[model samples]
Target chain A: MIIEGKQRIWADYQKEIADDHYFYVRSCIRQNFFPASEVTFWKIIRDYVHKDIFENEHHSSCSGIGYHSDVVPFTTTQAVVARQFALMTENGYKNLTSSCITSFGVYSEVLETWKNFPEELERTRDILYKATKREFEVPENVAHTSDLIFKYRNQINDMAKYRLVNVKTGEPLNGVEHIGCHYAKMFPSKGVGGAEHPYVLAGMIESWGGRVVDYPERRACCGFGFRQYFVQANRGYSVACTKRKFESMEPYKPDFILTNCPGCPYFLDRWQYVIAEMEGKTYGENGYGIPVLTYEELAGLVLGIDPWDLGLQMHQVSVEPLLDKMGISYDPVKKYLGVDNKNIGQPTCPSVLKV
Target chain B: MGKLYDMLKKDVRYQEALKACINCGTCSAICPAASFYCYDPLEIMEIVQSQNETQLEELLKSDKIWYCGECLSCSTRCPRGNTPGLLIMALRKLSQDTGLFVESEKGRQQLALKRAIGDNIVRTGYCIYIDTMKPERHPESGPVYEWIYNNRDEVMKRMGANYKGDGPGPMRNIPQETLDEIKKIFDLSGGTELFENIEKYSEQKAKEMGLQFDETTDCEYFNEIFTKTTKKHTL
Candidate 1:
């Protein structure tokens, strides 16, 4: 691969992510999949960086999943997205940032579609007015939550208690950075480093002292193909896609996988256990699976946040092994404790993955 | 040019996706679904470009259109800038609208998606509700999901989520009025019609196939589409 050519392409695809004051939207599945990652993004942006990121309680999903699944019509999806813009306009926020990569792609695609088809935009406006009586003005800028975190990675690293390095070895940990296909594949310029080599997650890894592993399948999908996984019978295709990625990256022996998308982390993390169960083969060292983490959890970790607080314990592939390698301290007794300090109970251990 | 081509040409997705087909096989080579399944975007695009109603009808009624993962990787690599993924979306919608989707094993799975993601959006205002994510139903969520599913309230609360509580934050309770607006939007924007057609056609197919049909997900037809997989799908 030509490094200079990739660098030239990356330079061309840099988008203008907003500096501050944004409207935040939640992912439909991210909260359920990685609840704390979204919460951590809010914490780091509001509590840590002191930015004005506003969210509306009444604002619902953008209907991207349903739209992509081919069940919801394009007109309905656009109208639902218009309602979100209406919420943002009503609340007086211009810049929009979403927690889910699919939602990010939806926002980008809708904006592009409106730019291309003025009649469709007008139709959507009428549909929103007829249904919700809401009028919307599109935001000035749209960005994924990772862009915001990447924008402030240096600031976060300044306050970090630990870097992305093994304390004992004094060597930087290798992080396999996976980009969600929708983040830029639909429109390359919508992402920080374009579709082929997205720097949104890589920038954060580099800023936090980690080596980005460019595996053969670095640009491959994590296989959260909405319907592919949603339907029970079609899961072989989903799992096989993920298995192809895991196999490609296994030779690199990366310490962990870093992901910006909500579904990427969940699938990359859980599918390891699934692959192990199906094939009796583990990807990590010594029968352990590679720990997959979202960008928010990684940022929270380096910033001296508790692993449990970042919802690390909720993962199928345990983060404890990585924590040990990083020399981060945590009390194992509190792993499954509730906010009330009661035991929330542990899951029955799988025979394959050593979680 | 035939009636099927005329109908396909009306869709915005068809207009946007089909610029021209040089048939370089770039899309099929880059497609993830093509890697594991007996699917080829280039072949599908060629069939659409041919505008043969016989071939187009066969393509629509077969599992071909349904095999797309919708990752749109094909959209990125097409030398002609023709998005076969979007074309598949247009075809899938056509298949569903014409009641031809239930003819194929995979096309019939649209009923499952309509029930799962479609109904979830109308009811909860989210595509995948936290409450509906049961471990028994979604075992691929991994073994640890049982713990998370059981202690969801406490776990979510601990993680600073609203966790079914009212007001703003992740997984917060979407107001009933908001859900009503969503349902109305779907009703006005052809979503409800699309959903109804799925059920209508699926029930007809169920009757023809000697499977029991019902309004709920517990019926035999839903089970058949939800769990049935043929060896033909794999490479």
Candidate 2:
């Protein structure tokens, strides 16, 4: 529990993250759940940070879900990811950044697998060539999109219109930063601040004027276990995982939960509503569950992006309370409206949780 | 070494994941699955280390092998650098390979995964498409998700996504050519074969269990595996 000891280890895990021109890949689930988060990322990087980021419409899902769920073979995952590297090589980019933490882990695993087993790497090359007639040189750098955001946190803060602070109280808001296990747990050296005390999200929390909540379950997974959630009956395990984290963090009274993983934020956000419905429990103040946000959405808010435009409305648990706490304004009427400004209709509220 | 051990030894994940086990409970202590389910990664490792064919075979056929969330939390804290999570991956693969996965309730769900995620990849180029995420299948997502599913086009348009349309953006309709390429990669890389194995074994198990099997998702066997749970899964 030595703070200085953790700091030293965190410093040791710092990677030489690239600053520009990364070939990007999208998550299969992230876009479906938080559609605008990636769009918000483009706006922040290309529009705000003034950096070069490229994506291929041809590149598809990294097959991490299939691979981890044990349907896709490791060789298949390697070849599929090799095709991604081929797309990058053809498009002439050397850096790779994926929006999903699972894809980040897949990439890290593939890279490590290749380094240890050149025959598998050769087989992957042959498979990619035979299938797509494409040749690939592995990217010079690999990073999660959040790592890129963390690298430019100071620049984002430099242009901040709002911060993670209670404007009324003038005290920094407490945020629980949860890292995806795949981000570093499997391969510690691949991540920003390693596995145990990851600083990727924590760095953003600190730089954006928020205090990090060191809850007992801070390092615990958000429990969007692919098969666990994908299969209906096993959902209890998934919800229970979220419940454990929420119970552990409740005593801290954190203002919000922040995450880098596609699944983490989705589960952390949606499960609160589910938990309240099932058990009549709520983690946040006064029947409102704690607001969970992706790193991009948090950045979008700090950059004065409209709450509705950032797609905070997609989240099951409402972000309104946290927005209000930060003194960020939004037209509550516009929350459920379409681009045509017509009411799209609202979801039925849960019994115990506010939406 | 026995048959099961021989097969496990061939898997790169098995080779990389299990180095040495001192029967340390660190992996089990850190495992989220272990906390909820009656699972012990330390015991799983110890059994694997014993090289006993009967124990390993029993493990492959049991619900215990399927309990891991694959979070790889067990991969991080092993004093011997033994990644029990990766070992679980290897054991699960062997389970599927030998048609033993259908013996347990959780293991039979492999067919559901093969159809949902595995088929989705070959068909849609994305492992999950919005059209497939029906609220009935995913009740945990709740009423908001149902609304979003119903009004997805407008919602996606507002979010600036292409929403199954062409060109680069989230949830955009992946091109047919790209889908073909992905299918080909799977074909050459043993994914299609693995998928076939899951189907072949699942269908066989369904017949043995006297459940209806069909090509589509709506079948007695799919329903059973997708919905079946035992109280033993939880504390």
Second chain TM-score, each model: 0.97, 0.97
Report lDDT (CA) for all predictions: 0.90, 0.91
Report the error of model 2 at residue A41, Å: 0.1
Q: Name the runs in model 1 displaced over 4 angstroms.
A: A1-11
- Distance (Å) between predicted and true CA of B41, model 2? 0.8
Candidate 2 lDDT by residue in tens digits, A81-177: 9999999999999999999999999999999999999998999999999999999999999999999999999999999999999999999999999
- Please give each candidate's TM-score: 0.98, 0.98
- lDDT string, candidate 1, A147-166, tens digits: 99999999998888989999
lDDT minimum window of 10 residues, candidate 1 chain A: A6-15
Position A10, candidate 1: lDDT: 62
Give the CAPRI class of candidate 1: high
Give Cα distance to truth, residue B73, candidate 2, Å.
0.8
Q: Write the per-residue lDDT of candidate 1 for residues B179-225, one digit (tens) a residue.
A: 99999999999999999999999999999999999977779999999
